[model samples]
Target: MSDAWQHWAGFMADLAAVLLSLTAAALIPILSVRALRYLTARRNDHQRETLHRIASEAAALAEAAFADGNGPRKLSLAIGYAQEQCAGTGITASADTIRAAIEKAVMDYNAMVKPWSGLPAPGAIAKPKGESYSQ
Candidate 1:
């Protein structure tokens, strides 16, 4: 009876060990995949924020450095500066994407600083010049 009990106990221990090993094997890959996904999302977010910052700064610099009516020159300066900055920071952005970002930044800046000059304010009426509000 004693020998039989010992054999049963050994079998149970071996079973538990195998189960633990299997659980760890199953969980490792799942955990690894989740970790990888999380890291990728964080990296992408960081890159996007960095690109936007660079675009905004480049746009402002171009606007300040160039005069009005030099649209093409200003765009060229902003794009070149943004591309150079991106390269210096190890970012890989195409010229079109950089241009789009810079344009967006400039639009946003303009909207903030000169709200009436661009698009009309939301829900505002467009009246002819010299027309009174009460008319």
Candidate 2:
């Protein structure tokens, strides 16, 4: 009959409309997640490269300071230089951290060099030369 056919057509139209709306809604979240992931990955790459550069420069400064003698004045200068280089470059470095790294490196170098200087040579016996401090 005509009434039954009309009812069937109305039901199918309603079902199609519901399916289309859901597909559109689901697309928004999928696109947003993809965009967010892309942005986060870019930021991480930049930070990693910057950190590597800061660490290398810090090591150079520490080595130079060690060669100049591990005195307070030299340490202070090294700290200041590192702070200037790494302060606002969007990295996680700080002056105190760099200073600590420099101190550790100096200590390690000193330990490595001590044995060589303290040990006597095969051809000569080691002893104090003279009272250089005598008045």
Candidate 3:
């Protein structure tokens, strides 16, 4: 009985050692790659999420400004904020140009829009800016 118990113990110890070595071998690179992927994905996701939230907020602000009929002043402020965000996102327009661009945006927004109406016109997407409005 004692001999049988010793054999079982030896077998168990060998299995445990093998398992530990296998786990160690598998764990090192797997943990490293998982950590690297998690960090990279987190950074990219954070940047993308921030940009998406900013765009949503800007759109809401512009829509509210338009809805409240706050006139050119509120819209101008909204456009200015949008322009700053665009520049932050690597767009190349300066604030002065962006201001003019905002005016064009406002014109486009004003066109095909009825301040009192509830429906959007066909194919009437709000442009970031419009050159044709000034020309």
Candidate 3: where are CA atoms >4 Å away? 58-135
Candidate 3 per-residue lDDT, tens place, 46-110, comes to 75555445444554577776776666766566666776787678655455655555555555555
lDDT of 1 by residue, 1-135 (tens): 999999999999999999999999999999999999999999888988999999999999999998575999999999999999999998898888899999999999989998878666766967778776664
Residue pairs in candidate 1 whose N, alpha carbon or C atoms collide under 3 angstroms:
none
Best by lDDT: 1
Backbone clash tally for model 1? 0
State TM-scores per candidate.
0.80, 0.43, 0.37
Looking at model 3, report the run of 10 residues with the lowest lDDT sum.
Answer: 51-60
Colliding residue pairs in candidate 2: none
Summing lDDT over every window of 10 consecutive residues in candidate 2, give the lowest-scoring window.
126-135
Cα shift from native, residue 103, model 2 (Å): 10
What lDDT score belongs to each candidate, Candidate 1 first? 0.92, 0.68, 0.68
Backbone clash count, each prediction separately: 0, 0, 0
Candidate with better TM-score, 1 vs 3: 1
58-121 per-residue lDDT for model 2 (tens digits): 5556567676666776667656665666667655565666667566655655677684876668
Which RMSD values do the candidates have, in order? 4.8, 12.7, 12.8
